[model samples]
Target chain A: MSECIVITSGKGGVGKTTTTANLGVALAQQGHTVAVVDADIGLRNLDVILGLENRIVYDLVHVIEGECRLKQGLIKDKRLDGLSLLPAAQTRDKNAVTPDQMRKLVAELKEHFDYVLVDCPAGIEQGFKNAVAGADKAIIVTTPEVSAIRDADRIIGMVEAAELPEPQLIINRFRAKMVQSGDMMNKEDILEILAIPLLGVVPDHEDIIVSANRGVPVAFDDESLVGEAYRRIGRRLGGEPDVPLLDLTVDDGLWTTIKRWMGLAPAREVAR
Target chain B: MSNPAPARVGGGAPVVVRTLSAQSGADGVIVSVRVDVAFDDVRAELHRVLGQTPERWRNRMARLDLGDRDVELFDVRRLVHLLKGDYGLSVTAVYTTERAVHRYVSRELKLQVFTRDPADDCVQALVGAVGEAGATAVTEVGPHAIDSDGVTEIVSGPAVTVEDTTSFETDDDVVEDDGAIADLSYDDESGAAKAAPEPEPDVVLPVEPMPIRIAGGQRVQSIPRSLRGGQSVRFPGDVVVYGDVNPGAVVEAGGNILVFGALRGLAHAGSHGDEAAVIMAFDLRPTQLRIGGRIAFQGLEDDIPRGPGFRPEIAFVTDERIRIEPWRGRLPTEQVATGDAPPSTKTPGDAAEAAPVTEQ
Candidate 1:
């Protein structure tokens, strides 16, 4: 049986699209056929992130409207054979597709793919409704900011209202340096607010941004730490019990290393 | 687009108009007039609606809702004149999203102008409000009006009196209209004519009390464990959390909220718009806090100190802005008298008494 998962965050710029692309790539890398559907119709970036925008001949709307067959609209990812994308129409708005239509589309995709990850748009509007409608599970994405966490809480409530199972949380762009310095919010703080089970924490890395700008999923790059986090999260979703959450603690300088070896420094204590 | 043929009396084109009659707090009726076209072009429609309204509704007050359009002073004055003079509808308030229209309606005409939410659908809004008051025996009216009996159904009967009274007291229109009247009488004209005669007999409009009843909720819902993210708890009266309100959790109450532990999630008190409602916690580091209509998010201040020094804080709406201060057991009346002046000592007591009402 295929599980349709919606990756959503109520606040904008909280890495919902990035998480969607990386997870799709991670799952596909594990030999599972995965389809990442972009539900953010007008503001689509999933195809670009998956490096398959140029290969798209027909989009989701075209398939839904029966202008093209579903096979014609599914753009195969350049990196993986098992992964594909059903790209959103950049010209059309979110209302172009209804929740019932999304359910039918997901049901069809279930016949071919093992997992379907729907990338939801920001806000609790038509886009959000359509994204959660077809999904059996939800993956709420948020940063370590109070504003983002607040929005995540709201999205959780909405997902529950939609009758989707308890959504998991992914904290992205987490900077341990700021968190240790008592400036930025930490994992504990975030977890406290959104009491949902933690999927994994993707540490803040500039390579993730660069990969996105270059039209590539960071999970494809072995050198990227965020990619490793995504892979572990992907394993966790695959029902692996032993995939530990990422430790985003900053390890800088020789003194900190010495303090760490001696077990003298508190975990959250900053070196500077 | 071709304009509809002009109406004989108003000389403006006949536009589609929708009039909604709703029950007021007082033993009377409140009607809202909605125009589909521009505010300036709604003269004929308003005229038609007002003309057809039953004579029994003559003394009732009505609000003009200018959907998505600004109102000029001339247009507002004309509507007010038509409603009050010809129809005796007593145009007391106008609702619009346009700032200029709000200014003209409030300042120039000395009437209340509510800043209507842009997302509000007229028919649905009335129905939603009526749905909340479903306990009140609603009667069917005309085709458009959801209630069939009458708008004044709640007025004569004591069955749904308390809730309706609460609704009336919190009704922004009644309070705003009273405020408008007070403002006009207190300004220039009253000062100029003070010595001439009996000081324009304080227009004792039966305005509801300022700190509207922060009392009488029989039950308090208590949560034993720390609320985790993705969890939500809502109660009609007060809510007491024995544990922390963790991040991503939501706790909403109609009255006030008291958290024995840290409030790190979204906490909303007075979800029904009672400005007197307050949210108090041992260490209030809420991601977002809402009291009545005012909302405040965390990180608004760059220098907010967290941990150990995390003093128990109380959040309440003051002068329309959500203000947070250390919960010092008692409201610092002398401090407020010397500093702010408006929120006196009683406010602190009111806040304390508001939540503890349902406490066993």
Candidate 2:
């Protein structure tokens, strides 16, 4: 379906851009024309994660200012079919584009793409307002912590106030062992505080950082657990039936135990 | 002029059109028109009269006599416009007996109007002194206008009141000026009658002085959306919020405060010191509750939902202190009151004396 969805977290450093890039790749890989827009005007990271940073010529501000056509500003990914990126201007501030311009841009993008995912900036400022102006749905990302959950609750209230449909939640960087050890909140706790539908959870993994450093989305890696989590999320958004959550508990698998007994791997989970 | 001389049409039959005439005096020239016929006939008659009068008379001040015939404001304004604009006649006063015509002429047209019977002797003598067309009598009758040349003397009309004469007294130069006649004799009975077109009946409004909550009340201020942190609302009446009042928000009302959702902020009802005002909310985990002048700091333990069920609660003043209770959906002292109140219905705030009903 032709729709625009904004991914936002009220607080920063919560994996919002990572989730957006992965979902955009996974959706485009499913043979759907998808456009991922970076709504963060000054601090843009979506193009870097999508590995299309070097191909940027005309950015969002240039298109809005009539300096370039919408097609000219859109950077299509050569690595994947039916995937494009609209990078934000890094030198300009959020005030460079208003909410009305973003709405018009999103509307024009929706006319050409099957899915338009907007990576919203942090906080409830003008940037946040501009990102959600034309979005038909919202996907809220929050980590399993009190501060993040509180901010998520506030964001939920704001998203509902903006008149979008009830946003589904993405519990990012969830650590099951932390919950088991009483060191962090569980998914149920975050869901109870935010009061939204749980879309999918991405376990805390090193693949996200590695993939981000290499300027590639983790969802392109088939064997990566985080990639599977994001693909399931993309499938759910595409009307796929519910898939079971990933097992993120301590490494007690038979293969892992045999490896540890053979002295090939460490007996304890590695410290961060 | 001589009443248009009763001219007949070419067929030698008398048409008997409405008459138009003019008389001049030191008070002003009076142009009386009997407009009881069609507007076309009045226009033709006015054109024929102006054709016969001396052209210099158009520059002199003129008072129009509407003469007991009902006239609309449109016809009056158009007639005045024709005399003032087309014929160049300066019309400053009007004489009409109808209150509606008088009100229109005096207030809307801003002209002096005399609302008396036309057959009065003072008006006739005043007409007689101005009988000799444009004669020398300065009929601006005052102590200064007495018998200036003796040939055209000020024949003070018998019906002229002392107050009328005193008000008409002007300087010697007033009779020579064009604008002096405009302010003559309009603040009399005519101005008072024109002030009220339809007589209004006396109305007395009932005022209430009590601060108690009656069965029916006054205005209720409503906020339809949630109040985020740092947002505050203050109202002089009862306040009803359809959404949550989040932490760090404040809501103060002179009457009862009602929140449809959670109230985790501070709420002060009866800010004007009406002690009966109560604060009600669906989730009443407030940081502080103040009713009237008394403030109560809420216990922090209730910040989390203590049980599985969520019920609306109420806070009100009890024994000079605030008391929070699980609301039973109905006021304990309120009766369904079908002709007679229930025996358990005490005063409105007597919740401590009655068994509260289960919340709906």
Every model's DockQ, to 2 decimals? 0.24, 0.07
Q: What are the lDDT scores of the predictions, listed in order? A: 0.66, 0.67
Q: How many clashes in each structure?
A: 18, 0
Tens-place lDDT digits, model 2, residues B47-79:
654644435345756666565555545567777
Per-residue error for B162 in candidate 2, Å, reads 45
Tens digits of per-residue lDDT for model 1, A140-188: 9999887888788778878877888889999888776677677888777
**Local error of candidate 1 at B2, Å?**
30
Candidate 2 regions exceeding 4 Å error are A181-183, A245-247, A250-272, B1-251, B258-262, B273-276, B287-305, B309-313, B317-360
Model 1 off-target regions past 4 Å?
A: A250-272, B1-360
Minimal lDDT window, size 10, model 2 chain A: A263-272
Indicate the docking level reached by candidate 2. incorrect
DockQ of 1: 0.24
Q: State the weakest 10-residue window (summed lDDT) of model 1 chain B.
A: B152-161
Per-residue C-alpha lDDT of model 1 across residues B182-222, encoded as one tens digit per residue: 22221223334333222111221212212222335445678
